[model samples]
Target: MEKFRIPAMRYRGLVEALQAEEIDFIDEAKEFYPLELVPSLEMTPYPHQSEALVAWKLAGRQGVVVLPTAAGKTYLAQMAIQSTPRTTLIVVPTLDLMHQWYAHLVAAFPDAEVGLLGGGSRDQTPILVATYDSAAIHAEALGNKYALLIFDECHHLPTDFNRVIAEYAIAPYRLGLSATPERTDGKHADLNILIGREVYRKRAEDLAGKALAEHEIVQIKVKLSQLERERYNQLIQTRNDFLKQNRISLGSLQGWQMFVQMSARSQAGRRAMLAHREAKEIALGTDGKLRILVDLLAEHFPARILIFTADNATVYRISQELLIPAITHQTPVKERHEILTKFKEGKYNTLVASNVLNEGVDVPAASIAIILSGTGSTREYIQRLGRVLRKGNVENKQAILYEVIAEDTTEERTSARRRGDNSPQEEKHKSGKLKVIYGTGKKQDLKAAEQLEINYSTQNKDVTNGVTDSSPKRRRNHPQET
Candidate 1:
C-alpha cells in the first residue's frame, strides 16, 4: 500500500475525484466535529427568510443568499447554523461586523461555546467569528478547523487578497451573504465557484412594505451660485480642452484609465486632473445644497435623520455649522460608539457621516435620510436608502430619502446614473415612488437675515404640500449638541 499527503484544502475535492475513479483511500484530513446546538430563544422567520433558507438547503447547503439590509439575513444565517450543526467559521468584512456576529451567536446558541478570532482576540471555540483580514492571514492554520463557512458582505471575497481565504478553507458547506452582490470589477462571477451559485435573491423594492418600511426616493435639483457656476464652467472647459488635445474620450471603456495613466507623466495632464477635480468639488459642495439641507432639517426636525456627504470636508463643515454629530472614518471607535449610542437613545436627533455608515455598521432606525452628495454607484444608493428603511417606533413609518443635486452641473448626470437612468432626460418622468423636482431659480437669498423659502409650489403640487418656509430665527436655532 502507498500513501501520499495532500493540502487540507484539497480534501473534499480529492475525495470526490477518488470516488469518481472508484479508487479506495483512507480519509483523515477533516478535523471538524458535528454537535447538538440549540437556540436560547424563539424566533419566527419572515416568509422571505424561510424561503431563502429552503433555497439554500436545496442547493446542497452551499450558495449565496441575497437579501436587502434589515430583511432578517442574520436570522437566516442563525437558522442555517442550527440546521448544519458543525464547527462553523463566519468571516465578516469589518471588526464592527465581527463583534456584531459574535454577540448574535452568543445570544442565540447559549449552550455552544462561541469565540472571537479578530480584534486582538483569538480563541478556539466551536463557533468562531473572524474578520476577513485575520482569516486570510491565518488561513493555513484554520484550513480544516471548520466544516461550514459563512461570508458576510461576501462581495468582498473576490478581491485578490481575500480570495485566498476561501481557497484555503476545506469547509464542505459554504454560505455567502450580501445586499448587493455585483462588483464593479466583475469579479462577482468568481462567487459561483468560491461560494456556490446564488440560490436566493430579493430586491429592496420587493420587500419594501412587507419586510422593510415603505419608502419614497425624492430628487431635488438646486442651481449653483452665479460665481460658482462660472468657475465650474471655466474649470470644465480647461479639462475638456486638455482631454481634446490628448484625444482622450471619457465615454470609452478604457478612456478614464488611460487618462489616469497619462495624467501622472506630464504637467498638462496634472493640470487637467486638478481642473476636473475642482469642477467636481464645486458641483458636489455647492452652498445651495446646504440651504436645502437647512430647510429639510427644519421640516423634519427631531426625527432621527442621517445626512450623507461624499467628502469629509463637507461632513465637518456641516457638523461645525449646524452642530450635528459627525462620524467619519477618522472618528475614534469609542467616540463613534458613544455618538451612535446617543443617537439611538434620542439624545441626538441627527447624525452626519461620510460613507462610513453606508453598510455593515448597526445604525438605529432613522426614517429620514438627506443625501447632500454621493457617487453614482447604485450599491451606494441602495445602502444609503437602506439606512432609513428599517421600521422604527413610528407606526406606518414612511422612509423618505431626499437626494439634493446641483442642477445644470455634472451632478445631474451622476444622480441619474445612480438611479439606474442612462441620462438626465430619462429621469424626468421616472415613476414608482421617485419624483423629480427642479429648482425654479437661483438661490440668491442665502444671507443670514433672509428666510430661505424652499417653495416647491411652482414645480410639483405634491412637493409643495411638504415644502415650507425656514425662518432665519428657527434655522439659526439648531441643536448645538455633539
Candidate 2:
C-alpha cells in the first residue's frame, strides 16, 4: 500500500508560518500550573532556557523543546512535570530511552511512579514513559489515561500509524523534545500542528564553553589501505561516471542508496563497493580513536562504552571480530537484557552496535561512545553523542565520542547536508562534477589518524537532583575490583 501523506490544509498552514517567519500552534491546556509556577526546581539556567520556559508558558505551555542534545532537554521536561503535577505520559523513541527517562523522572520526583510501556509496560504510576510504537498502537487500551503528554525525540512522530496517539488522546498539555526540529525530507509541518515549532534552539558552537557542555568535533580523514585503494579508484570512477552520465544530484531520489546498491550487484560492482566500504573500514580500523579507547578503558576500566554504526553488516562484522556483545533487531529480548545488564554491571568494557542505540537508551556517562559510521542526520549524530553524556559518579564525566570516516570518497562528500548550510557533497562530487565547497564553515573528514584519538571528552562529575558529586574528580582504580 502507498504511504499516506500529511494533511494538506494543516501542512500548508505551517508552511505559511515558515514562509512568513512566525510560530503558531494549538494551545496546551494548562490548569494545575500557570505561567508563574511552571519551573519545578532551581538550577541556574542560561538566558535561552529562561526565555524558553517563558515562551512555553506564553504559548499555553504546550509543544516541543528543540534544544541541542547536551542542552539539558530532560531538565525542561522535569520542570514541566513538576509544575503540571498531574498524571503524565512521557512518550519516547525507544525502550532504551524509555528506561533513561524513567530514571531521570524517578530521581527528580522520587515519590512519583514513573511507569514504563515498552520492551515491557510496567504498573501504572502517576508518571509514565512509553515508546512511540506503544503510545500509537495501544493508546486505546490506555484509554485517555494521561493529563499531559511529553514526546521525547518527537520529530519522528509523523508516521500515520504513530499519530494515532494524538488522534485518540485528549491530553491538553503537550511537550515535544528533540535536538532539532528539521526533517531530512522537509516534512516537519506535521509536527508543527501536532506539537509546536522551534520554541528554542542553540548551536554547538553557540553553547561551547558557556551555557552548554564544552564540545569539540575533530574530524579525521582515513585513507584506504593499499589493497583497498586499488579497488577504490575504480569504484570512485564508476560513481563519477554514473552521476556524470545521468546528470543528477548524488543525494536526490535515492541517489546515495542507489549508488551504493549498484556498486554491490556483481563482481565489478562488489569490487567498487568494497573499495568504498573498505575505505571507511580502514579509516575506523587505523584511526587513533581505537587506541584512545584502550587508553580510556585502561584509565576507567569500569566505564560503559556504546559504539554506534550506520551499517548493520559492519556491526555484525565488528561484534564477530572483536568478540564484543552486539545488539540488533534480531537480538532477542532476554539476550539484549543480559548483554545490557552485563554492560551496566561493568562486566563488559565495550559494546559494538548500530543505529538501535542512538536515540533511546540510558548509556552511562563514565563510558565513551564511538561512531564507526553514519550519514548526515544531525539529530541522530547528536543523540548518539547524548547517550554517553550522562553525569557520572567518581569517574562519571568521561563522556567521549570518536567518529571514523573513509577518505576521498562519498565519505568525504557527506558533510554538505547540515541544517541550513550546504553539506560538503553540495559542492564536491555533485551531479558528476568535482568541486570543493567554498564555505564559511569548516570541512570535517575522518581519518585513521593515531590508532584512536578520542574525538570528545567530558568530566561528567556534576549532577543536579541525584547522581554524581557537585564537583569533578579523577578516581584511581582498584586491582581487586573487576
Candidate 3:
C-alpha cells in the first residue's frame, strides 16, 4: 500500500521474512531495460559449461560458480547474460580485469552499449562493468541500476568494504565466480549471505585433460650457500628468541598481527622483525634457487615460462639477472599491458612477476611456471598453479609448475603449509603418477637430475596416444651445472 526502500544487499532475506509473515508485496525495484539484439556466440560452450549454466539456473539464477582459470568462466558469464537478457553489472577486482570484462561484454553484445565505471570511464549503459573499488564507492548510487549482478573473482566479495557493494546492490539475480572460493580469513562463509551458495564446482584436476591442461607439480629443494645459511640461522635465532621471550605465537591470524604490532613497539622487537625479514629474504632469494632457475630455464628452453616471486624486489632481481621482463604493482599500466601483450604474442618466452599476476590479469598460457617463493596461503599457491595450467597448443602437452624452495630453512615449512592436503602432488602421488625431481647439487643427486631431464625431453612422446608420460629421464653428469 505504501512504497519504501530497503538496502538491496538484504533483498533475499527481507523477501523471505515478508513471505513468512504472509504479507503481500510487489517488487518494483527491478526496472525493465530495453534489450538489444546481440550477435551469436563466436564459440560453442563445452559440455561442462552447459552443465554449469543449467546448475546456476536451477539454483534460481544466483550462486557462485567455481571453475578453474582458462576454463572460460567469462564465456559462461556471457551465456548467463544471454539467458537472463537484463540490465547487468559486472564487478571485478582490478582495473585490468575491469577492462577485460568491458571488452568481452562489448564483443558479446555488440548492439548493446557497454559501459565502464573504472579506469577513469563513467559510462552507464545497460551492460556495465565496474572495478570493486569503484563499485564500493558508488554502491548506493548503483543500488537499483541493474537487475543482475555478476561478481568476477567473487571470492573478494566477502571483505568488509567490498561486501558493501553487494549489500547495496538491488540485483535480484546474482552470480559469483572464482577458481578458489575459500578465503584465508575464513570470510568465504559470508558468501552464502552476500551472494549465494556455490551451485557448480570444478577443480584443476577435475577438468584436467578435458577442460584444463594436463599438469604436474614438481617441488625442488635446494640448499643455501654455506655463508647464506649462517646468516639465515642467525636471523632466525634472533626472531625466535624475541618470540619466545615475548610469549608470542603466530599460529593464528590474529597472533601474527599481534606479533607485527608488538614488533613495531620496541627496539628488540624491531631488530627481531628486521632479522625475520632478512632471514626470509636469504632463504627465498638464495643464489641456489637462482642457479636452479637457470638450470630449469635451460632445460625448458624456448617454452613459455612465468616466474613468480614473493616480493617486487625479488621479481626485479630475477628480471635483471635473467634479462626477462618483470611486472609488479609499481609497473606503469601501459608498460604492464605491453609486457603481457608481448608475452601472449610469443615475443617474450618468459616473464617474471611478483603478486600482480596471481589473479585478475589474464596471463598467457605458459608451458612452465617457476615459483621462486610465496606465502603460506593456499589461495596464493593455487592461483600460481592455475597460471600455467591452461591448455597448451599441443595435445597431451603437460603444464609443469616447479616450486623451488630453500632447503633447511623456513621456506620448507612455507612450501608445505601452502600445499596443504589438496596439493596436486598429493593427488598425483595417490594415483602413483607423481613426477618429482630433487636437485641438491650433490654427487649422488646427479641421477635424479638426469631422470628429470629425460622426463622433460620425453613429455611429447606419448602425445598421439592421449596417454600421460611417466617414464623417468636418464641422469645427467654434473646436472646442477646445466
Tell me the TM-score of each prediction against the true structure.
0.85, 0.66, 0.83
Q: Candidate 3, 183: how far from true, in Å? A: 1.8
Residue-by-residue lDDT tens digits, candidate 2, 218-291: 34455666766676566567656655654535667587677667656666556555555654555445434444
Q: What tens digits encode model 3's per-residue C-alpha lDDT throughout 22-57? A: 465565554534354475556778766876776666
Query: What TM-score does candidate 2 reach?
Result: 0.66
* Cα lDDT listed for each candidate: 0.79, 0.58, 0.76
| Candidate 3: pairs in clash | 9-167, 450-474, 450-475, 450-476, 451-473, 454-473
In candidate 2, what residue range of length 10 has the lowest lDDT sum? 462-471
Clashing pairs in 1: none
Error of 2 at 144 (Å): 4.8
In model 3, which runs have C-alpha deviations exceeding 4 angstroms? Answer: 1-5, 10-28, 34-37, 422-482
- lDDT winner among the candidates? 1
